[model samples]
Target: MAMRKFLINFNYLNNYKNQAVRFLTTASTLSKNSEVLNETATELVKSIVEEYENKGKMFTLPWVDQHAINSALYPFKELLNLGIQPEFLEDACLHEEKLFRSMIKNGQSIYKMLTIFVENFIMNYEDSIRMFAKWCDLLENETPQSIQSRINLFSGRGLASGIGLRRIFEKCPELLFGSEVQKMDICLEQISNFFESGDLKTIVNNTPHICLLDPTELESKYEYIYFHMGFVSEELAKSKCWMDLDLFSIIDRHSLLLKTGKYFYPDPKRPQLKKENPSPELIFDTPENKFANLVAEVEYEEWLIFRELCEQQRRLEDKQEPYEKIKPSQRKAFERRLKEKRENMEGEIE
Candidate 1:
C-alpha cells in the first residue's frame, strides 16, 4: 500500500512538470510571434498613411496603440484572406473608423463575420462591402447568441429560408441589430393568422420590410383589407403595394372608388356584382394618375383634389371635430364641386 501511494504521487508530479514546461514554451513562442505581428501592424499603418497622403485625401483612423494594432492584426489578415481588397479595407478604415475600431476592440472575428454573410447568406464580396458599416454595427451591438437567435428565427421558419432569408437580410439588414425578436415574432404570428401559408410566404418574400412594421399597425391593415374591403388573403398577397400604402390612403382611395361606382366589396350573395369591380391590383398597385385615369375613370386632378379633402377630413377627425360641424358651408361647397366634377367625368365617359 505504501509503494502504491508513492507511485501515484510520482506520476502526478511528473505530469505537472510536463505541463509547466509546455506552458513556458508556449509563452516564449507567443512572445516572439507578438513582436512580429506588432512590426507588421506598424508597417500596415504607415502604408495606409502614405497612401492617403499620396492621394491628397483626408484620412481618419481611430486612436490606435500597440494593443489596438495587435488586436486588429488577426482580423485584418482574415479580411484579406476572405477576398476583401486592401483598398476596401483602407477605405473602411478611413470612412468607418469608429466602427472598424469597435469591431476589433470587441474581439469579433472578421473571418466568421464574412463566413456568415458569404457562405450562409450567399452574399458576394461587393454586397458585403455595400453593407459593411451596417454589418459592423450589427456585430458590435449584438451578441453572438442574439444574432444566432435571429438567424434561427429566419432559418427555422418555412416562410423565410435559403433564398428567402438572403432577400430579407439584403433588404433590411437592420433587422439583425436589435432586440426585436419578440416584436418580429408577434408580427409574423399575426401575419400567419391572417394569411394562408402560401400567401404568407409570398408576402414575406416579396415585402420583407413588412417585418419592420408595428404588429398593431399590420394587424389593423389586415383587418381593414379583409373585413372592410372584403379582400381575401390571396388577393392581398398578390397586391404587393398594399402594405406600403398607409391606412388612410387605402381608405380614401377605396371610398372614392365606391363613390365613383368603380369598386365593390366582394359579396357571395351577389356574384354578378363582382364582375364589374376592379381588381385589388388595379386599385392599390397603381399610382394616383393611373388609378384615376384607368380604374376610377376620373381625371387625375379630381383624384388629387379628393386626396387633399381626405387629408383635411382626417385632421378634423383627429381634432375631435366633424367636418360637417366645423365647416358645414365649406363642406357643402366642396361636395357640390365634387358632384359637378363627377357629372362632367360621366359625360366624357358617355
Candidate 2:
C-alpha cells in the first residue's frame, strides 16, 4: 500500500512540472510577439516622422508627438499600400494641414475614396493623388456614392467612358467638385442645339475647360462661330482651339484677315469665289509671331502696334471715355502701309 501511494504521488508531481513548463513556454512566446509588434509599430512611426521632417515646412510643428504619430500611422500605411508615394502625402499635408488631419482621422473613408478612383476610374497612383489633393476640401464632404454619381453625370450620359472621364478630369479636375455638374449639363445642352452629339462630345473631350465658361458666353461664342464666321458644326468641332480663343481675340483676328483680303466670309451661293484662306486652326492656334509673319504676312512690329492700338481703343470704350480718332497724318501713315500690302497680295494672286 505504501509503495502504491508513493508511485501515485510521484506521477502527480511529474505531470504538474510538465504543465508548468508548457505554461512558461507559451508566456515567453506571447511576450516575444508583443515586443516584436511594438518594435514594428515604433519603426513605422519613426519612418513617418522622418518623411514629414524631410518634406514638411520649416515652420511646422514637430511630428514627434505620440498622438500625432498614432493618428498618422494606419492612414500612412494604407496610402503606401495603395502605391501612393510618400512625397505626395507630404505635399498633401503641407498644402492642407488641417484637411489632411481630418482625412487621416477617418482613414477608411479616404481609403475608399482613393480606391474608387483607382478601381473605377482606372486612375494610376499619381493621377489619383493629384485629383485627391486638388479637391480634398470638396471630397471631404463627399461620400464614395456621391463621387460615383458625379462621375456618372459625365460617363453615364454617354458623354465619356471610364477612360474618357479620366481624360476629362486630367484636363480640368475642377469638374470633379460640386455645382460643376449643373454648369456642365447646362453648357452641354446649349451646345447640343448647334452641334450633333458626336461633335459636341469631341469638343468637350478635347477641351474640357470649355465647360467652365458661363452658359451665355458659350452660346455667344457658338453663335459668332456658326453665324458670323460661317463655320459649320463639324468644322468648328474639328478646330480644337476655337473654344479656347476669347471672343474679342477671334473678332480682332478675323477682322484683320478681312481687312487684308486674306479671308472672305463663305457664301453658300458663291462658294467658287472663296479664295484659299487660313484655316480656323491656323488663324486661331498659331502664336502671335507666326500668325503675323506667316498667316498675315505682315511685319511683326506692325501687328504689335496695331494690337496695342486696338487694346487702347477697347479699354477707353469700356470705361465710357470719349473716343478720339487717330490724327489724319497718323491714319494716313498706317493706311498707306496696309494699302501697299494689299496691292502686293493682289499682285501675287494675279
Candidate 3:
C-alpha cells in the first residue's frame, strides 16, 4: 500500500497528486503537547472544510464516498459517539508519527523562513506558503542575510543594499530565530569580534572599503563623504544624497565625511594617509562592533547627565549656596543610577 499525504488545499489536490497521497496517508506525527502542530492541524481542517462546503467544489474519486468522507472527517471533529470527546483521534491525527517525521526530514528552517516571507508579503497561510515557495525559488542561489547584514539594516546604514533581513525577521519570527535581535548589541559584539580577529579578510576583499568607518557617524551626517571626496578635488561633488556609495569606496567615504565632517574622526591612531589606491583590507573584519558601542553609548550618556548635574550644582555653589562638588563616590552612584535608567528605558540589562 502507498503512503498518503493530506491534500490540505484544493489547489494541492489538483497540483500535487503524488504529494497528496503522501500527505493524507502519511498521517500527522506532531508531539501531543506541540501548540504549533495542533494549530496547524486545526487551521488545515478549517481551511479544507471552508474551501469545500463554501466554495461548492466537487472532489472526485477518493473524496466521492460520503460515508468515507464522513469517517475521514470524523477524526477532525471534536465530539464523540458517546457525547464525550474522542481524545484518542485528536492525539493520533495531529500527532501522527509519520507526518512529523516527514516534516523534520524536510528541514524546519525553510518553514520558518516561509513564515517570515508570508508576513512580509502580508499573505494568508496557504498564500504565504506559495509565496515563500516562489521566494525560495528566486533566492535559491542567493545567500541568506548574515548578522552583519542585520546590524547594517538596524543602523540604517545599508540603504542601497536592499538588505531588509532584520525587518523580515522582526515581522516573521517563524522564519528566523536568534537571541541577537533582542540584544542588538550582541550582533554588534559578534561583528566586532570578527573584525577584531580579522576573520573577515574574505568579506573585506569583496565589499566596498569604506564600510570600515564608524556606522554612527555615517548615519548621523552625509558630509563625511564630501570631506573625503575633497581628496579627489577641492570642488566637492554635489550630494546626490541618493547615491549608493557602497559601490565606490572613495565616493562613499568621501561623501560621508563631507556630510558629517565634525563627526568624522582623524583617529590619531589611524590617521589618513595619501591614497595610492587603498586595499579592501582597510575595512574592519569583525562580524560586529555592537558590544563596544553599547558600552560607549551608556558611558557617554552617563557622562552627559553627570556633567549637567555638576554644572547645575556649581552654579548654585558659585552663589555661596552650599552645593558641593560631586565626589568620585557620588559620581559612581550617579553613574549606576543613570545606567539603570537608560537600560530600563531602552534594552539589555548590561
Best by lDDT: 1
Give one digit per residue, the lDDT tens place, for model 1 in 202-301. 8877877787787776766766666556678888898878878887788888889988987665555667667888777887899989999998899999
| TM per candidate | 0.66, 0.61, 0.23
Per-residue lDDT for 1 in model 2? 35
Predicted candidate 2 versus true structure: per-residue lDDT over 235-279, tens digit per residue: 778777777777767767776777676776564455753447677
Give the alpha-carbon lDDT of every model. 0.66, 0.65, 0.33
Model 3: runs farther than 4 Å from truth? 1-104, 107-113, 119-121, 134-223, 226-350
* Candidate 2 RMSD computed on C-alpha atoms after optimal superposition onto the true structure: 14.8
Off by over 4 Å in 1: 1-46, 53-67, 80-111, 124-130, 133-144, 268-275, 304-350
The residue pairs found clashing in candidate 1 are none
Cα lDDT for residue 317, candidate 2:
72
Worst 10-residue lDDT window, candidate 2: 319-328
Best model per TM-score: 1
Q: Candidate 2, TM-score vs. the true structure?
A: 0.61
